[model samples]
Target: MKNIVPVKWLLARLYEPDIVIVDCRFQLGNSNSGREAYEESHIPGAVYLDLEKDLSSPIGEHGGRHPLPDIAELAARLSQVGISNESRVVAYDDQGGAMASRLWWLLKYLGHEAVYVLEEGFGAWKKAGLITTADQKVLIPGRFLATVKHNMLAEVDDVRESLGKAGVTLVDSREAPRYRGEAEPIDRVAGHIPGARNFFWAEGRRPDGTWKSADEHRERFAGLEQDDEIIVYCGSGVTATPNVLALEEAGFTRVRLYAGSWSDWISYEGNGVAVGDEKNQ
Candidate 1:
């Protein structure tokens, strides 16, 4: 709940000048659908930020499917959308906060500490009779700057070194089937990094598609020590962000994101891959 805001919380501050709302709705294969959806109807005054366009850089040989965008370019884009350093940002998506969390993580990494993810998806907002508009608002550009946080990320080498090491937990945020190598819908590799434990990212949310409480999140990660160094990853880097946010909500202080994730791990020939349920160390 620390970095998540409810619909009511957003509703009251909808028209505020300093509060900027971003729509981060994205579907993996249908990239254009997100933009089209936003154009159709969205929360009034919300600007659409595409995942493939704004959040990630072009794919390379090693940086996985969705590489981190260049900080300066992203900052310029943020400024164009009127997001300054003082802006209180609220990002939302219909995909259970998966895409929204990417922006949330990126903003935090950029050292903008006022960013938060919307608790419920956009559909819930429409169902509750909240306003939705097709009109786009013209915005004055802001003076946003980037101050990258290097400590929030874990490179492939950092993960490789942490393998089988004490006081470090490598969490694979993919589904059970993908983690167990039963089925891989995306990515060339079918298995996970060796010694990584599976913790599906959607588990952080309740059955109703809303996020769980802080105590509930703590229970989800009860096996993990608060002091342990937690490294979270998914197929690419996108879905892993929810787990990163969840860990923080659970009161874990040492969480870091493996931005390249499994796709990048297997891009190298020498990396080890595991195919079954591994015991949590």
Candidate 2:
């Protein structure tokens, strides 16, 4: 499956044994937050994946706060959650595809093409008048054949090249403050790339946290040239995914994620760092 699926499509597959639903609601500053919403209600039969507990590895100074987990370990984790190569996985969260896209990308990384994200996520599912369930089930383990998708990731070297390449658009998906060097909540240095534009990933979603329509997304990103290659980044790589996912939905053909992002960029020894509107300077 592609990166996104309509809620109606996923609803039809809800009861099929070949499908697995995952709830990925997360509140960035509040560690104990998401589960309450999940416990309060979720898509029927969905298993919850916690950002702090399940989706990421522990933080270290040298590592981004949300380092992508080891494939072997992540494979094992998926297996424990009853995900198999044959299973079609659908991940969703309250926010656009922020946390959900992480799992969507992870599934692709694991070579599972049957995986997809709920286009507008759980928020839209509920608004469609679907019934919610408080019944979260424990999954039975199943083996998965893990295969990593290497090209989906943008390395530090890729960003370096993008600085000099006129055809590439390095997009910073962090909030305007962070992108403008007005704030530095997660990383030590407070700055953006030498020539990166601000996309403000959250703009793709509504106040309720569901993703907007593809047309709306296309309009928001209308400032960019269609032929330019896009590389998206946030605090780490986690938050930027919704922007990448949004671009995908908007009909942009070539978009990639900077897996290490600013966390990896500024911290590297001898790497150049810049603050404030670096988009043209």
Candidate 3:
């Protein structure tokens, strides 16, 4: 519930015992890349969470490249990693906040509130001249419970129900070209949900790949109704978490993530995924 903390604040909390820092730096081209990075060096006293091993049920065609694993499995994983209900978690990745926010939203989706994404990520940490260590950590086993909140998710039915309705805003977090159907890297189809606005999550990143200031970010979501409920999605459920965090940071509290995202949405046989310059639509 607190504001997104800086790397320095996280370093200050490094030895708190109740703090859990997960390094999420994964290369999309090679899944094992993150683990290699962690093996080389990571935040002093930080642990590596393999995107495929530690997270997700498994990669599949219908489930996108990475699908949300069952709640019980995730709960058990967190518990196995020594996270408890009282533990405060900070998740981060090198590619802006895309991968980091996945863990952040997963904690929230599984109903854990004490989670936050490292504002800039591992790059920012190294840039700050922070210490790194290759020492492996051993977790003291503890029980962690999650109260799954399904309402925070929006399915195709909910999107259909809200279309043409007043005070409901849809945002696609995919790149502009991808949202326009001009490019398709991971998914079979391009474009986005009809009546959705574009806010490419990568745009929030600076040239150095750190997140922008709250003021500048707030301006990005400007002109939208603060009272309107915001539903955000991307290739899958991952990238959209940054948008959720961004809007929440901007003081818009009525935000939800379409966990299925565009990948899941387009998989629907009859769903409408529009193409073209949908910026103003």
User: Largest lDDT belongs to which candidate?
Assistant: 1
Write one digit per residue (lDDT tens) for candidate 2, span 1-281: 24678888988888999899999999988977889999999999998888867877777664466877777888988888888989999999977788998888778766788878887788788889998999878678888979877777787888888886878888999988898899998788898887888989889877765567888888989877777788988888888887887887788877888877899787678777667876555
Model 3, 1-281: lDDT tens digits are 35367888898898998998888888777988999888888887677777677776676656555677878888888888778889898888887877878888788877789898887888888989988888878767668898987877787688888777899999989888888889989888877888898998888766766667777788988777889988998887878888888887778878888877888877778878788875565
TM-score of each: 0.98, 0.87, 0.93
Winning candidate number (TM-score): 1
Q: TM-score for model 2?
A: 0.87
Choose 2 or 3, whichever is better by TM-score.
3
Please write out the lDDT profile of model 1 over residues 78-195, one tens digit for every residue.
9999999999999999999999999999999999999999888698899789889999879888989999999999999999999999999999999999999999988887988888
Output the lDDT of residue 190, model 3: 78
Pick the winner on lDDT between candidates 2 and 3: 2
Instruction: Using lDDT as the measure, name the better of candidate 1 and candidate 2.
Output: 1
